[model samples]
Target chain A: MSDLKKLGVEVLSMSVDSIYTHKIWQEEELSKMVEGGFPFPMLSDAGGKVGQVYGVYDEDAGVENRGRFIIDPDGVIQAIEILTPSVGRNDAELFRQVQAFQLVRASKGKEATPAAWQPGEPTLKPGPDLVGKVWQVWKPK
Target chain B: MGEEELDLGCARPTGGPVGVQPDQVPPEREGKSIEEVRKPMVSVGKKAPDFEAPAFYEGKFKKIKLSDYLGKWVVLYFYIRDFTFV
Candidate 1:
């Protein structure tokens, strides 16, 4: 989405819908009601094939529940979030995580960011000296 | 609920159904229920199952696959419906 654009990340949406239906929604509804039509592709699992694979497809509800999977560059899943239909997703946290994941991967797993880690902030280096003394040196903002 | 709903951190969903839905989903989908469909859940640290389906892109419908994004960080998200309040 536009929020992820600054972080150099792209998104893909999947649902138990048809491609044609998505086209119409993106054009008539999403574009008119929202700021922009989805910048990324929206996959339609009409038959619930991929949905069944991810367990997001609700066979009983006749819809796909909210599910998010953040896969790394190497095709490894780094994070996962699933929510019910009533609740919406937190795009702010999702954007922050994308940055964190990228930073960790850039460090070749040598550095790990603590929770609520923001960009340009100091990342933790796993070692003995930082084990028990983390609180002593880490300056929480 | 209206005032509190406005305080939600997430963005409000816009638009209602446009007369047409995702395409008429077959009533008997492989004769499977939620329990049967979710029997095997995808776990982390495992290779994501690669599958292909029709995706809307550039104002056209085309087939897209998970493998197409093998080299980039992908955030694959799924939501309920485009129009519903959810």
Candidate 2:
């Protein structure tokens, strides 16, 4: 989370569970998993009103499914991931996405990150000349 | 349909092509667009819907708003329920 913060990202987690449940879960379950519990806010979206907007709520089940959205500073969503309960999200991938988004925004769409691109890695410049020649510039290792 | 049969992008079993045969139209969903029947999915490149809700933070209950984090990248995620594994 500190790494996300360093990139100017704020994480807000929400669920249909009540605040009391959040408190209990954070104190008992999360605290044991992460030191001092979560550094970000755990929101209670009772009745799934907020989830309904994001398309994660299951009205029949009265619960929200797993969903994540990466919203840029302009309040526009940059990415959306909706998964079933059986799968867990990868924190490293999430962090990498945030870093990639930051770099893309900084470049104003002039540069694009390749698959699994990390900081200081080469970024592709999208143009007609670069087309069909990407293999010459980027080789997966 | 049972929950297990619910696939993410599967066409409604009231089958045939997406144009929908009149006889197979689900009564309640008749005349409704796919977007209306399904949950309102916010797509990328669209404005993130703003919401204000009570939040638990630092052992305290505080109201948090999505717009409050404007001018900063926001990782807004929704999980199934509390007390579940990550």
What lDDT would each prediction earn against the true structure? 0.71, 0.78
Candidate 1 DockQ vs. native: 0.32
Could you tally the backbone clashes for each prediction?
0, 0
* Candidate 2 per-residue C-alpha lDDT over A1-141 given as tens digits, one digit per residue, 9 for 90 to 100: 777878778889898887678889989888888888888888878867678778898888888888989999998999999998889989799988888899999999999999879888999999998999999889997
**Positional deviation of residue B50's Cα in model 2 after best superposition, in angstroms:** 0.8
Model 1's CAPRI class is: acceptable
Instruction: List iRMS (one decimal) for every candidate.
Output: 5.6, 7.1
> Candidate 1, which segments miss by more than 4 Å at Cα?
A34-36, A139-141, B1-38
State the displacement of the C-alpha of residue A54, model 2, in Å, after optimal TM-score superposition: 0.3
